[model samples]
Target: MEFRYDKEADANYVRLRHEQYAYREEINTERRIDYAADRKPIGVELLCASEGVDLRNLPEQDAISDLLSQHHIKVLAS
Candidate 1:
């Protein structure tokens, strides 16, 4: 998995797999889920990421937390 932040867009993306992109599911104004052709989740995108992200609904919370920490991103507690 990989954690990437786009400063210009204020977006944070968590890539769960390196695979072809199929489509995306918008969870809301601030969140989207990317899926592969098989409908398996391949990535997650958090918009307005500078505002912080909630990890409760995501997988690999611990690893994601570490990655976010490395990038100086905030993880909001639920």
Candidate 2:
């Protein structure tokens, strides 16, 4: 997958387009998990090189690590 940063928007987003049914199914599963969670999730766009990239493939911790490494952003462990 590929990642791109949008300087003007001050954000990084991943784009994925699905042309297969399996990919659609995977996305549905992720949506269900997100909905079932007790805490609300903040939606952020991501950039991906693969079509139909699943957000589930993007782990929260990994993203946090990337944020910290790329932008020197810190996350206080709670």
Candidate 3:
């Protein structure tokens, strides 16, 4: 998983490549739970703006924080 901000393009995106499914069942179950909970899960990549809104001038960390804050979403990781 990687987080990057493109200054020229003024876009912020997150890239997560799953090399292998270590716990396929667990992952699937979690996905189901999310759906059942009626939560619209958002990935980092979806945050990118394709309209050429460059956000790269700002600090990457700050930009990410702002996005989550605006969405009222809390990032939780184990």
Give me the candidate number with maximum TM-score. Answer: 1
- Give per-residue CA lDDT, model 1, range 7-73, as digits (tens): 8999999998898999998877887889999988889888888899877666567877888889888
TM-scores of the models, in the given order? 0.83, 0.29, 0.26
Per-residue lDDT of 56 in model 2? 43
| Model number with the top lDDT | 1
Candidates ranked by TM-score: 1, 2, 3
As for candidate 1, its clashing pairs are none
Candidate 3 residue pairs in clash (backbone atoms < 3 Å): 10-53, 10-54, 10-55
- State the weakest 10-residue window (summed lDDT) of model 1: 55-64
Model 3 per-residue lDDT at 60: 46
**What's the lDDT for residue 55 in model 2?**
37
Candidate 2 vs 3: which has more TM-score: 2
TM-score of 3: 0.26
45 Cα displacement, candidate 2 (Å): 2.1
